[model samples]
Target: MVAHSAAKKDTGGGRESGSDAWKNYMRRQTITINYGRELPLAQGVEFKI
Candidate 1:
């Protein structure tokens, strides 16, 4: 759940393509991953279930 807006500034496509034209800030990022408890490969190899 990430939301950020405002973007439309890029003047570069010549002179070796290099320019952001000073992009006036625009960012939005979110990553959430939760995983826990996991142990079971072959409960018969002396792992005893």
Candidate 2:
């Protein structure tokens, strides 16, 4: 997910006056597996470690 916002910058020693801020959130997942020699290898089997 992502969000955007803006802020203003002041000419004086104040905060900037620009409303161009972006916030991003990320989600990730991981999986693990074990295989044996007796199992037959399939033609379209993707392996990840």
RMSD of each: 13.1, 12.4
**Pairs clashing in candidate 2?**
6-19, 6-20, 7-18, 7-19, 8-16, 8-17, 8-18, 9-16, 9-17
Off by over 4 Å in 2: 1-34, 38-40
lDDT of model 2, residue 28: 18
- Give the CA lDDT, 0 to 100, for residue 16 in model 1: 29
lDDT tens readout by residue for model 2, 1-49 = 1112222223332333221221111111111122444236654676565
- Candidate 1: where is the Cα deviation over 4 Å? 1-39, 47-49
Each prediction's TM-score against the native?
Answer: 0.14, 0.18
lDDT of 2: 0.30
Model 2 residue 15 CA deviation (Å) reads 67
**Candidate 1 lDDT for residue 46:** 58
Evaluated with TM-score, which candidate comes out highest? 2
